[model samples]
Target: MTTMFRKALNALPRLGVQVVDLGPGAAVISRRGRYSATKVSADAWMVGGGRRSTRAPAEGWGLRKAAASSLCARHVADFLANYEVNCVFDVGANRGQYGRQLRESGYRGRIVSFEPVPDALARLRKAAERDPDWWVRPVALGRSESVQSMHLGWKTMNSLLEPSAYGQQRYKRFADTRTTQVQVRRLDKVMDEALHGIANPRPFLKMDTQGFDMEVFAGAGERLDEYVGMQSEVAALQLYEGSPHMTEALAAYEEAGFGITGLYPVTREETTGRVVEFDCVLARVSSVPGSAAGVRP
Candidate 1:
């Protein structure tokens, strides 16, 4: 099919045509016009040009949004609405997937996304280009500040920790062990700068740093209390060496006064159908400085 499309493109008149590869799921070629490519499913692409519909085709981040809205977006939306969240610190925001889902869920608050991978960061920046409230930081948040080697995994599965042997076998597609050095910072150190001009910053944290969610949370230090709600990826089976277990991470959050709001499965073991990880949503019900006092609706 791609060959036929290329042949057709070659036969077209050189009428100042331009082509843009809109990431893995879509591509667009136009001559003073616009086109859209929607990923209807994992292996399908639907391309269209100029259209108006009550429900537009999912493209790029919209594809991710559609996929997430079906799973955890509703819960996340309720978290934001319930807590009156004003800003979101999207830790490990690969290509702004979480941010896009936030927008899709009708949360128009500020989004500060942090990512380290070069290619993913490029796509993430592009996705946030037009949104003044969406900010992208090309750095990984961790327990400390330093330059660390990030283990490259499949898609958004890259991590600061090495992949475990069982993890490698269980997720063969994520077994690529390439490494890239990226800047790592403690969130507390950069918090002021990231939220400089934002007023009444009732922050919500959506952490999906592969298996390093706890480290990112640890990096928040005393500033951790500034967030009203959080979503962390908890691994039931260790996917990354040195990653905290599900119980340990959950206990830590509970110890920090966060109560469970929801637990959404992220992946399941194929053979046993057992959950491998979960998107653990938690909220602080107590009145805090970041929420319930002058926070915007």
Candidate 2:
């Protein structure tokens, strides 16, 4: 399409036509033409090669209050309720989405959020400012403590690792990235600092580090057992370079004596209906604080 025509299409929102940008080199879609527009866009993408918008409706942090009522969030609420968790360590807590969702889910515990990217950390801090129990730490968690280069992609996609070819091709936002130096710390080294004032802490670790879950878990080291429950993002395919697959991370957690409590898909391939990644929740096997009705074996 010509630039002039594209501009005109983009201006359609003023005329009651909701235009959604599908990303670079893809066609824009109007609300009414969504069905046909998607089909044509998919075909064009396959032939000319363009990334899909991996952003999902559920990913809208602003609508997290609505999301908290979802089955996945309810599962989390039930987990916290049954286990009596008192604190949460939210790793890769971009803009405090998880922590806020926890609150909306009726979790009245302490939350310590860790984030490295300047843009996200600022927003995360602002989000947590009014909540006295929510704290923000401006450092990324990794296997070792050091200064590392973080690849800043579209806010939610920022990561310590570069996006893989598949990742870049799968999501338009992942293709655009700029690097920035960030402070990385091992969780073991900062555990005391994170839990400083909390007495009798029963912590739950929630990790969504854009394919760096295992690295963050490794950073917890032998102190991992201090957390009663844990959640990690696992992928069926490599989104970040050198990232482990789902099996590797799951096996490692299983070996560490945690059993699966919930596995929720984060995203999926539209055409193939194949899950791309998941939020896997696990709890210490023999140490579950209460009855195990919904908890998976």
Candidate 3:
């Protein structure tokens, strides 16, 4: 009887039902799906052939509470099927969420990830442990190789190599924060070593290192040829706080034998009150003569 009840419950659309199995005298039931903060009293509810005590949905007991939970996973799956990409370099890998997402979406290729934060790097490593194609590195990529003090944000979400005074101040609004000294390496050196002795290296690089995207390319130098395409986070609003402007950054790509092929807006105007908080510029390396012969602008 209990097995039948469990099967029936599982068959129901897993929208907002948190089912807990407690032996005999105790069973706890809570809402699943969407995140919320509310308390409800436990009571007995009838199921299959038994009556067990469970907490009603914090709001109420009905399917109406589950309407907001959309099938986002399906959409993401569709996207992965349609997009054609091979090698992926995830800069600012954080906890390797993007890497995991790629794998889950059936992306079977080399995935190189970089994370400067020690704690975050640890988590990223654990997350990618099962994936052999996922490579995680702990060095921060910049224009030069040097030890730099990075500002640690409250929840690892706001950590940045170049945090603005305003950003720091805003971060202080919350407690529980710490800073650490991290090693910074030049992308030029890293890429040269990674692509060394290889006949043809065509990798897709995605960079999101707060305000240090331009410096990363600066370090890539001539080896930027190994990367056929790239997506970099360009901070227009934070440009005044040390980030290079979009125009200047794109010019650097042009000098490096790359052309701006696409742009994706990260933060919209309705949320940030700015034209575009973060811009993802897609660049492709030129294959023409004298393309790789000039210095970055």
Candidate 4:
């Protein structure tokens, strides 16, 4: 595919075609990158030295721009609406997947996304480019502020912990494929710098840190008091070393003044039919804020 595209591009010198390799088997072609490559096509060669939807986007970001970037999660939508959540901390955001979903669900508030993977960060930045309120922080969150070697998986399963045997048995595809030294910061510290002490933050944390969810939560410190709700991807099996059991996580959250509101299945052992992973949606044990406040109808 590269050879074919290179050979074709060889003849388009008259056109100001600048192509940048964005990821594996993916490239972004632009006149000068004035428009984003949300749905770029390598086949859309220089037609009269102009780019449109047929060649490149001529106008704004729209539904025709890229693949479906929406997850109509009714439960989450209801929770976010009811919580009056004004600030969303999207931890372990690989490529702005959840932020995009929130936008599609009519959420028009501050979405701060954290991503550590370089390749994934580029994609996340591109996705966040059009949204003025969406900010992307190229870093990871952990219990401490330092550099850590993060295990790289297929972008989704990447984590700060090595894949355990329990994970490999469920899916060999989730094995740690590589390692990268990434900067890690405490969530409480990051919020101080990013938010600058904005009053009434009404924060909602959405954590999908593979098996390191609790570690990431620890980074939040006392700032957990500012959150109205949270949702985390919890491992049922020991997917990583020292990973807490799902029940333990639930108990801990309950002790910390939160309650399990919903559980969404994420993965299961194909052979035994036991769910290996699920997302735990949590809300404060006692209400303090609002209902349907910061979301669009």
TM-scores of the candidates are 0.74, 0.75, 0.61, 0.71
For 87-179, candidate 1 gives per-residue lDDT tens digits of: 899999898888887897899988999999999999999999999999999999999999999887578788888888878888786655788
Instruction: Please name the candidate that would achieve the greatest TM-score relative to the true structure.
Output: 2
Cα lDDT tens digits for candidate 4, 1-297: 457766655655467776654445455566653444333233331121234554234433332222111121556776887777778899988988888888887888789999999989999999999998899999999899999998876657788887777767766776538888999999989887666555657778888888778888888888886677888887777888888888888887787778888886666554465767778889884654433432322
Model 4 whole-model lDDT (C-alpha atoms): 0.74
Best by lDDT: 1
User: What lDDT, from 0 to 1, does candidate 2 have?
Assistant: 0.79
171-203, model 3: which lDDT tens digit per residue?
Answer: 453344567888888876676445444454556
lDDT of each: 0.80, 0.79, 0.59, 0.74
Give the C-alpha miss distance for residue 136 in model 4, angstroms. Answer: 0.4
Q: For model 3, name the residue pairs that clash.
A: 188-219
**lDDT, candidate 1, at 27:** 53
Q: What would the per-residue lDDT of candidate 2 be over residues 1-297, giving only the tens digit for each residue? A: 468767877788888775555555455454553322222222232111123335423223212323322546668878888778888999999988888889988999889899988888889999999999998999999999899999986768788888899998898998667899999999999889778888777889999999889999999999997888898989997889989999999999999989998887777676576778888889986556645642434
Compared with the true structure, the alpha-carbon lDDT of candidate 1 equals: 0.80
Candidate 1's TM-score reads 0.74
User: How many Å off is the CA of 161 in candidate 4?
Assistant: 0.5
